[model samples]
Target: MADFTSRRTLVLRRFARNRFAVASLILLVLLFVGCYTLPAVLPYSYEDLDFTALLQPPSARHWLGTNALGQDLLAQILRGMQKSMLIGVCVAVISTGIAATVGSVSGYFGGWRDRVLMWLVDLLLVVPSFILIAIVTPRTKDSANIVMLVLLLAGFGWMVSSRMVRGMTMSLREREFIRAARYMGVSSRRIIVGHVVPNVASILIIDAALNVASAILAETGLSFLGFGIQPPDVSLGTLIANGTQSATTFPWVFLFPAGCWC
Candidate 1:
């Protein structure tokens, strides 16, 4: 416990020492708060139609203006952000967890187990994930599709990371403690969980952070391509998609979401 605390403190100190990382962390926190909370506080709804205000420029009355459907641009963008965040965070966690588990097992227990897992990883590497997602997502309904989107991304995202984990675990598994645990009749699962997992956790944590950004961008791209969140289900991607044709004439529609995407 003391060792874990010291490691955590060290990580915190390391993170704090990096000015850009600190600033980015603060900015992300603020952005998340604004995206998730401001919508409930505001009077506007993403789906609410204001027939009189179609494509109006930004004003105090409509902060980011209105879309062609007269939906509040600010509200739509916020809603999009909320969905995107959900997909990003969930996919990152799920992907990282799967990666850690798969990698640990494959590495620790070599032979057919390793062969099968590596084979699957290699197969996934060659697969066209986004196109498959595009082909399948539209068939699912909106709310369910969002969950499915997270699952699909996480499912596809873990392969490379898992292969990395397996390599790390291969080294860790041959350590004295691991061998000792095996000789002492400690369960393979327990040793992997208590020893192997923690040792590789730092890598997984970093990968998860990176995965969130990747997942968010993936969601944005898929949604923009009309395979993700879909219409009436506004996410930043959908908002950008809606604005594409009139991006020149009504730049606010496209630009607001694009800025948020950045």
Candidate 2:
């Protein structure tokens, strides 16, 4: 218990001392809270239309102003945030899970498994992920398209994570405790679950955060191109896409969503 406490304190001290990580964590938390709370408390709905008030400039009543369709820009931003964050979190979790499992299995049990998994990883790494998503999304139903995109991104995203985990596992498998466990007749599964996974978790967490940012950017790019979260739903990317047409006339339409991205 004392050892665990000391380790945790050390980790916290390290994290606290890292200014970049601390800033990122603070921004992430603020965004997360705003995404969760603002939509629920706001008076306006994302889909609500008041054509009479269309294209109004920023005022006391409409802080960020009204869009081309007369929907509240503020409301749209809040709602879009929720959607963007959801996609980012989902992609990160799914991608990390797939990467960890495949990488661990392949790394622990070498020979053919390692060869095949590595080959597959290499094959995926060769292809452009965005191109793959664009091709695959159109063939699927609208609802399924998001899932397909997530899976496609996760499938490709796992390669780097797999390689990282595989490398770590190779090093970890030869550790004194691991060798002791093996000598004590511990099952491969037990050694992996009990030893390997815990050791690799810190790297997994950091990678996951980086992946979330990447996934958000990718989703935004897709939505900007009209391939991501489609109509009747709003995302930061979709909002930005919609705003582009009216931006010259009503700059707030684009600026509000762009502010959220910043």
Compute each candidate's TM-score over C-alphas: 0.87, 0.88
Clash tally, candidates in order: 1, 0
**Candidate 2 versus the native: TM-score?**
0.88
Compose the digit string of candidate 1's lDDT tens values, residues 113-167: 9999999999999999888877877633467767888899999999999999999
Off by over 4 Å in 1: 1-29
Per-candidate RMSD vs. true structure? Answer: 2.8, 3.0
User: After superposition on all CA atoms, how large is the RMSD of candidate 1?
Assistant: 2.8
Q: How accurate is candidate 1 locally (lDDT)?
A: 0.85
Error of 2 at 154 (Å): 1.6
lDDT of 2 by residue, 210-236 (tens): 888888888888877877777778888
Clashes of 1: 1
